[model samples]
Target: MTSSFAPDSLVLNRKLPLWYQVSQSLRASILGRSPDASLRLPTEEQLAGHFGVSVLTMRQALKELEEEGLITRHRRRGTFIDPAARRASPVRLLGSIDAIVAQQSGEHTTILGHGPEPVPGDLAAYFPQCPQVVTYRRLRRDGENGEPTNWAHNTVRPEVAERIDLADLERWPMTKVLRDAVGVDIGRITDTVEARLADPVTAELLQVPLLSPILHYTGIAYDGAGQVVDVARIHYRGDRFAFSVTVEAR
Candidate 1:
């Protein structure tokens, strides 16, 4: 490892199985210690001592990681992180939210619920011809540490809504899901991020305390033909995320 291979506090959560918690802790720890994917994990005996767990428990955690395809164990060489776990740069991710989420290790989205709903008047103005929309309400959590990160609500125009599969939404990012379902290319994405305190419902869904600070984001996407493709509102846990922008000097 770079400097340390110690497990984070994530490994101490007693609510989950010990091995699972250890696995999540290790997954998050990998990116820090092996930014280049060249580091080999410490042996099981050492890791067990470091984490205050038995060798068998450590092996179970390693097995969980292996099953997730995040690590490879060799008979003589020890365990190494899969090269693909390396995260992309921040500027690269700004091109598309979906692209960034896809590249994040142990990031996953679950559809808490979905149904037909009327498009809000402001969002509806973007689609004069569509009167109603289908909505998907989802929660995004860190796959590694099992922390709730965001609560997102997405509404699609009637035409494209009919083709969407909730399953696909869970598996793919929003942009790709829209493109594949509509068979059209996305031309533009516009979004704004602001800070706000979480409301009761939002706090409950995000598992944050009421009145906790949150990053509220809203966006609208369009197709090449200039038709509104989708509208979304997302509430992210402010403490868990950080945003950086690259400024160029003239």
Candidate 2:
């Protein structure tokens, strides 16, 4: 039988393999039904019986859905649909360093490497026509002598270059330097996040085995006229960092 999955279309359920068919059915539910943003999803056995599939096959389909970021599973709790995006726009802001750092109960930092480097083409694509960019690459440690938690690569416009001093960065974040020394008011920002296996360089820096998972967060800050003032990538230590969001109606 032909696969019945439709990207955004609902299913009427005809003749199809139970697991393959259920995958499509759930996809439709995620897009159309708009399940409660905070509600946990039903159990695997429950889902298997609900759709007439063996538990093992049901699991395979669920794994596929999780890779698509359609759902998440906790240790003991059942699987849950990812309702953050459908419920509301994700949180995009400039106060991330303070917002995250402050939440830690103890001192959680040790900055390593801060200097000027030409921004990558992918990141440069986000900027307005500009010559030369300065970027700060800091290896942040989460605790005193803790494993390196992230490689924070921050790229900024030339105008903001003077604010960064490698000699003093061991003491402060470049975000603060932009406001305190460079005189630019950070009014808006945007962040995009993804979870993936660590690349070779990141694997070594994070002290993780090859193919170990990592959370990557990329972000950009813009000027009032929509010029891209900064682009940054943060590779967070997965075991230590928890990326979460809350959704509400607009």
Candidate 3:
């Protein structure tokens, strides 16, 4: 018997396998549905019955949906659309470093390296009495294409550093990580943006040519009681991002 599953237009091919076709159709439906509508989808058995396929086929389609981050299947709670999937938009300056990262929920981060390092003379002004810190470097990439978009270097006090794990950095921003690890509440974040040509190491990490234009960011974050929590230097591909600000009339 011919497969009854409707073709998912997003896939751009009608002759694909039955499971692939059904998954495309279901994904398109969930994404196009109203934001307020029920985010859940039908059970595997019901879906299979509707498509004249076995439950295994339906499960295979659902697995694709889960892997694409379009929908999530709970052990007993059924499958539901991922809210973050729909909400991800191009990165924009909302507020704070953490806010910027959180806004683009679609991007993925990889920790390139992490280790303790001596505080630089310039950065030491922010930390004052602290002599050493731990540094963590990360590469942020496009979720769909896996293209490297930005790189960040984060430095924190040893106490706060000890509390952070490579896994924690993967899921949360360094700012939030500090708060969760040591109860550090950030009070102010100072940012300085500049334009510069990429260095050899940066070009390699960002996959851009040496001397490519780059946006350089230097940020210092302070805690509620005016203690330094962390400092960061972030480099973003110049073509991939824009900064926005607002000013009031004098």
Full-model lDDT for every candidate: 0.70, 0.61, 0.71
- lDDT of each residue in 1-250, candidate 3, tens digit only: 2222232243224455777766755764554454456666778887787766689988998998898788888999988778765531233454665674464333688888998888978788877778789899888888735878788898888877776777877876676676665577778877777867689989999986566557787778888888887888888775455454545465
Q: Report RMSD for candidate 1.
A: 10.1
User: Ranking under lDDT, best-scoring first?
Assistant: 3, 1, 2
Write one digit per residue (lDDT tens) for candidate 1, span 1-250. 3453444454365655677657656765664342433557789998878777789999999998898787899998898778666442221225565654353222778888888877678776886876678888888777735877787788887778788888887776677777765575788777777867689989898886566557687777788888877887877765454345544575
Residue-pair clashes per candidate: 0, 0, 0
Winner by lDDT: 3
List the RMSD of every prediction in angstroms.
Answer: 10.1, 10.3, 14.2
Q: Candidate 1 or 2, higher TM-score?
A: 1
